[model samples]
Target: MSTTTYAVLVLIGILFFVAMDLGKRDKGNDVITLISDDDDQEEHS
Candidate 1:
């Protein structure tokens, strides 16, 4: 209806697509794998 409305709609659409993509990628693997690396103190020491 208005330029501002169209702009807001487009911004929302882009955010939705980005969230979907992140969720899809997260489903395939163990998200906690990064935590294992955090336990390795030898590397930091």
Candidate 2:
């Protein structure tokens, strides 16, 4: 296989492991959210 092929294979393996690790951490299937301050809302009023 060429260098590019090897690099792609390695990337795929890394992504697979990362996905599995993330899946294992799930509990009760809860959704995670990022809350931002409503600074713009205050300024517009």
Candidate 3:
């Protein structure tokens, strides 16, 4: 009935859907990697 009540309800709804989406996501395949030979050269130098 109040503005605070409406805001709380909307926040709850958004968080519930976000939790569901995070649960369904992949565990490892989404990883990104950078192959930099710079690190190896730095060690030698």
Q: Which candidate achieves the best lDDT against the true structure?
A: 1
For each candidate, the alpha-carbon lDDT, in order, equals 0.78, 0.69, 0.69
Lowest summed-lDDT stretch of 10 residues in model 1? 27-36
Best by TM-score: 1
User: Which pairs clash in model 3?
Assistant: none
lDDT of 1 at 25: 90
Cα lDDT of model 1 by residue, 1-45, tens digit: 699999999999999999988986986355455555666765787
Better of 2 and 3 by TM-score: 2
Q: What's model 2's lDDT at 9? A: 96
Q: Regarding TM-score, does 1 or 3 come out ahead?
A: 1
Candidate 3 Cα deviation (angstroms), residue 40: 49
TM-score (C-alpha, index-matched) for candidate 1? 0.57
Candidates, ranked, TM-score: 1, 2, 3
